[model samples]
Target chain A: MPRFNAIFFKLALNSLKSRQGSVILTLLAIIVSVYVLIGVEQIRMQTKQNFNSTIAGTDLIVGARTGDINLLLYAVFHMGAATQNISWKTYQELTTLSSVEWAVPISLGDSHQGYRVTATTPDYFTHYHYAELQPLQFAAGQPFEDVYDVVLGSEVAHKLGYQLGDKLTLSHGLGATSFSVHKDKPFRISGLLQATGTPVDKSLYISLSAMEAIHIGWNNGANSNAAHSVIDTQSLTPKSVTAVMLGLKQKTAIFRFQRVVNEYRDEALLAILPGVTLAKLWQITSVMEQSLRLIAVLILISSLLGLVAMLLASIRERQHEIAVMRVMGASPWFIFSLIEIEVVIVTFVGYVFGLLGVAMSFELAKNIGLEHFSIHLSSNIFSIDQLIYLALILIAAMIAGLIPAVMAYKQALGVRLD
Target chain B: MKTSILIQNLKFSYSPQSPLILDIPSWHVEQGERLFLQGPSGCGKSSLLNLISGILPLTQGYLGVLGAQLDTLSGRQRDHFRAQRIGYVFQRFNLIPYLSALDNIRLACIFTDQQQDSKQVEDKACSLLISLGIEQSHWHKASHQLSVGQQQRVAIARAMIHQPQLLIVDEPTSSLDHQSRDAFMQLLLRQVESTPLTLLFVSHDHTLSSYFSRSQSMNEINDA
Candidate 1:
């Protein structure tokens, strides 16, 4: 039976070989469609995963009364400028609450090169987690202990070629090409954080005291005046901070802690669950994702239609071939299955090549995306959803091929009679 | 003598609304006999052969081929019967254009589930190709690449490879010149010499009738 099946398979292979021009064109259409379909799906899934994995273990992000997504963007992603900063006293008061197990205050607004400088305490290294509660392991040196010491994210250290003990001064503003550089007090690179494949890889970490010491004489977001006190590291204390990340001892107390922070008597603060806010952000951006998916499916459907058309067009030319097979004792079902087998073979090969193309393009996109956009695309290429999509494509191609298969079957039967 | 084909009150047409194109009242051919059926174009000679081979459905008649009543068999059964017991050769483009000459011969036995060794089938195919004068080098080339005479010879090999009980040759010599036609007929006749193969050769040309033992014109049998 296997040998008998081999004959038909060989015939189909030879038939396709004879008609390489149209076959390759059909294959190219299928390949492009599959590539687009899988590529868009990969980006959508990877983007959502990358966003969801940026921060974890921290229960609530408390910022000075802003939209949830805006707070997340500024506090965790460092994407936009913070409109208001919560007083440092509010953060201290929140830490003293019974439900708040630990709190790490983050003061933003200083930049070295293009990387943001996050001002936080050493407690941040112990409390903060990302991507399934993975702790922040330092690749070199310890967390910032001195007011003049600075720790660099893996990206910043690697991109700027900064090693331990390298001194770089921070800019006053957040822009990449800031002119208001603090020339007097330069901080040494005390530590380098290992890559976490998150936004944590793109920031420089410094103590809150360093943040206040650097802005000692700055009046209105400008360079210091001539009479500014020279390097007062001992008496420095931060008055305000951009946001704070809190981790509770009990998971059930998250909502209560969030409510307590939101209705604080001293300041107008907003506490947001990182996961819920991320989901909300995705919901807002899901329309574009859905549209991309629709376009990919449409392309795949049209390409499958093209395959059907190609087979339909070839059936007429193969009338004599079908007649010969019929005379050689092939049933109408044989003719029907021949066309189907051809379609399956074409689609399967196209799918294989499309997968290869996806892998190659992802490899190329991974580097560029990480360098320019700081978007870490995961390397795990094939997933269950992708396999399901492939199965759907095969089934769709089979269904589309039926149009021509039925026509050929009818034609073969007609040839035998007439 | 065992009858290879028997037809009585046989009728065929393209559709129920159309007039009958073949109305053969009675006809029979004995096993191991070579019968030449000569006719001009559109005389329903091919249609008569189609009915006898179970290629066309029998609407009204008693039709039998190789001792089996074809009219009583289902379409699928007839297909299986043809695959195991019949060999058919078309006039032109008899071979699949892309398959090799050897592969074309092997195609004849593809549908049958006979427990034959593949090595044996391949050896028989090779010997048949060699006997039909198809060169060993040309055996693997695409059938379309062969010359017309060579292709006709390969078609004869393909038809005879499965050793069917009934061999139907429909104007197989129409495309060949006189010499190649004679050569094709000589190889075809030699293949059926020792076997109980009932040869039904159909053609519009009359010159080739001398090669068969019996001859009949379309007007003598089919009354349309």
Candidate 2:
């Protein structure tokens, strides 16, 4: 630094020291706004990650003809009832296709306690994959093989106090007060799934044979099984299934397989590419995300404005100080740069506060967020997005500082030291 | 001869529309001369001091200080020239409020070329402060904490620290009592006498001019 600049820098520091309270308040406002921006952006990114992580390995989701997002919600997330179901024959035919490696048929529309009851096959334990192509791991026992055997996800078992060999009955539908129960063949807990942080954790799994046997004597959704003592397993078969998750042997065969599934002659069905559909889902909800971003930007603008207001208000009192440096032969540019330096100091401190706030918050909430929402937020301080935000803040601070800096220059050049 | 300041047919105003605030036909201060310029209030004494120091723009003038023509140089060049050779003491003793007395004095050399060895500058500053009746204990105190008389002495020490060839004193004793004003004048004249300096001390109090070699009123010299 030039010698005059060193002096002016010290002068600016002393000037700020004289008026520390207002500067501190402006800095606090900036810190809080930056904190909000970081929090909102981090959560948004991680939630999208968690959603995409839920169904990563599955190549296609096969469901009765519906919107892509609707199928995603009803089939993958258990969010809504399916409009229609595919016949068991259609599911079997899909398994025989040359592109298909395996297909897990999931039968829905039932609940055990409050958790969704899904009837799948033994192949589901081996073929079904969630985030990172991870196969389901058992916390206890193994996948169900008998008709009345059931497997509980970690969350369900933990919530309902179920252990291995514990017996639980299934309700006829998702209704809270279901009039029909499968009392003839209650299921014994055969396995417990390790926590996967997906919709799978909120559901119970059973064998497809158990589903067919439970509704053996039901006539058009009415339970008539009270007259029967036992059902013949050899004669029972599932009439329909809610959806099928398909994995292709070759990833390139997805487009052809999806086209064929959508144009099937026997069944009216839609095959959704999970990744593409998830992108569209994000696009539909981007309006809300944009609104949140707008709010964060507005807060930053207001805080920067507060900085401008404080500096502008102090310029009148600082004109004499500027004149003092001017009489000492300091240039107008020196005064201008000095005022800007003060702003940079304040803004840099605010940025430090923001970074630490976000870092400490993640450290505090990491485990809890993972356990509850499966949102694995990164604790790393500087992502590309974060760097962009910091750069934008620096530009804003410079702009804010430029106002008072220009005014101080003019005032110093205009005033008389005497 | 290389006179400290030379002015001929000088005129100045704030703007083109305003009347002239300063218009002088001729003026000159020779080297090693202690001249007193006495004028009443609003007689443009401060304006004249500002012109001689090149703080104001010279619109129509043949003005020179230490053989350098004033109007031929840009504003930045004039600032550099002022920092190099001229020392000005304002009417209010304008020391920065935030800095200590020593720091305020150091500011004069901070922009000048006389800043090679900081310890040499400190020793010279301390000797001046002691000779000007400022004790060693009060040299590091902020200017705001000092009395008006003490601040006036620090301002004088600051103006003299860089050892300028020309010293312009602009009514710096306006707030001092009679006893302190006489003592300040005595100390200032003694310091100027100790060196071959051209002194231009301006004030409305004509009684203070008795210590100088010569005296002149604003009406006698100012054409405007």
Candidate 3:
């Protein structure tokens, strides 16, 4: 290799080695900031990925007239309150659309503790797809085959400590508060679905007729309620549902079918594209994302400021050393370059360690998050935003060192050879 | 004798509004001249040496070293000239604490772009240490690990390693005891005698000036 400017590099290396403790401390501060930045970014990206993948293979979510965001909140995630509920007749009419390939009705109203209770058909387990079009897989037993049979998601089972053949009653509303449970008829846990790292992980799945069956004894016996009250397992009927998920035969006809469902005068219904509604949800949360990004940047700035302060504080102690180097023929610029080079080296090392920390954090989060919120952490760490963040860190570190570097240069200029 | 350093009507002030610290109407030193410039504390002896070496830009008048005008050179050019032609030994014997004595000596050669074989440089540095009465065992020790007297010897080795035309010694004996000071001055003068290097030894001890062929007091050089 060609000879380096030894006066430059040697001074930098020697200065760093002489103040090894302070240099290491500064490097550690940078590493911590980088770790936090990458950590927050990884969670944000993975959260979005998890949200988008929560309900795949569904072309449209048809529900009561509401904004696309509210429709998605209630229909798919079972979050927030429903603005409206589609009647059973509207769901039937949507199922009859020529463009519809398969339609799965969902009724959401109750909860088993914090986990939402979703009432749907067997097709939810058979035809439903999540991330990468992967259909739901049972980690324990089979999907619900009877009206009063229920399938608990992995999180719901793990959190509530429920097992196959366990019987549980649903609470009246979706909130955490529970006044009464449908204790007269409890649903038996027929299966536990594998963790999908989505809302599905936090929901209880039962047949629509089972939901209707639980409410059958109320309201003085309407025929619709009376029909679902019969304990003769084969004699129940689901009179109404909250919403329906539809997959189209031809994706090109999604808008046409959505319009068809929206024009249904029989009930106040709305058809929302899951992808479009996901984008809307992202918009609603964009402010939070921006604020988080800003906080990460501010933390990085503070870390760099700490680095600058540390380096500047050491400048006084190194003044004699710098004067010695100056007498040895090293220029003021050489000293400046030396300080800058140290910062760059530390920054590069911190960035590498930060990326490693992010990867490790993601691995840890993957396991815990799946068991908790069903959000899968992605393995890709070098996203464009992360690269930009790394670049910003480098620039910021260099800028931080500039203060000490300029001071060193000025001191060197006035240095006397006494 | 060839003029190694020449100062003409040179004046320096710490600030534009401050009183003049040094005002040398004229001074000249020949090659191989061991001139002991003696003065008490606050007498601007160090400031004059700084101006001759071009570490401090002359505020007024001209200075020439080895036939090159220092004031005409840019900061970078002046630094290169200083590295190539001048060596300095400070009062504290300021050697980088982490570096071995040999490495510290080699740093001078490295900066001057005067490549020397490590074995040859090590042999020369060790020989200098031995000549200075330092033991062989302390040659490879870090500068800080060595005693203050030993570190002063190492600083002398570093200043002489590159064999520059001018050697500036700044009160190297100030911090030494009487016996150590006498021994250090003897060893330092012997080394300077072996090389054709001009010596500008600044000190407050006028008794030490009798050893030099030429001597001047700062009181005589500056009217202050």
Best by TM-score: 1
CA lDDT, every prediction? Answer: 0.87, 0.83, 0.82
What does DockQ give for each predicted structure? 0.53, 0.46, 0.50
Q: What's the residue-level lDDT of B13 in candidate 2?
A: 82
- Model 2 chain B scores worst on lDDT over the 10 consecutive residues at B107-116
The pairs that clash in candidate 2 are none
Lowest lDDT sum, 10 consecutive residues, model 1 chain B, at B109-118
Q: Record all residue pairs in model 3 with backbone atoms less than 3 Å apart, i.e. clashing.
A: A197-A374, A197-A375, A198-A374
* lDDT at residue A169 of model 2 (Cα atoms): 94
List the candidate 1 regions with Cα displacement exceeding 4 Å.
A1-4, A137-141, A155-163, A176-183, A219-234, A263-266, A416-418
Off by over 4 Å in 2: A1-8, A122-150, A153-167, A176-180, A183-185, A188-197, A227-237, A367-374, B100-143, B156-165, B178-198
lDDT (tens digit, per residue) of candidate 2 on A183-237: 7778999999988878888889998888888887777888864676767888768
Question: Model 2: which docking level applies?
Answer: acceptable
Deviation of model 2 at A30, angstroms:
1.4
Better of 1 and 2 by lDDT: 1
Candidates ranked, most accurate by lDDT first: 1, 2, 3
lDDT by residue (tens digit), candidate 1, B149-187? 898888878877778999998888878888888988999
In model 2 chain A, the worst 10-residue window by lDDT is A1-10
Give the poorly placed runs of model 3, Cα more than 4 Å off.
A1-10, A13-32, A81-84, A87-89, A170-186, A212-237, A345-367, A373-387, B15-25, B41-43, B115-141, B210-224
Error of 2 at A411 (Å): 0.9
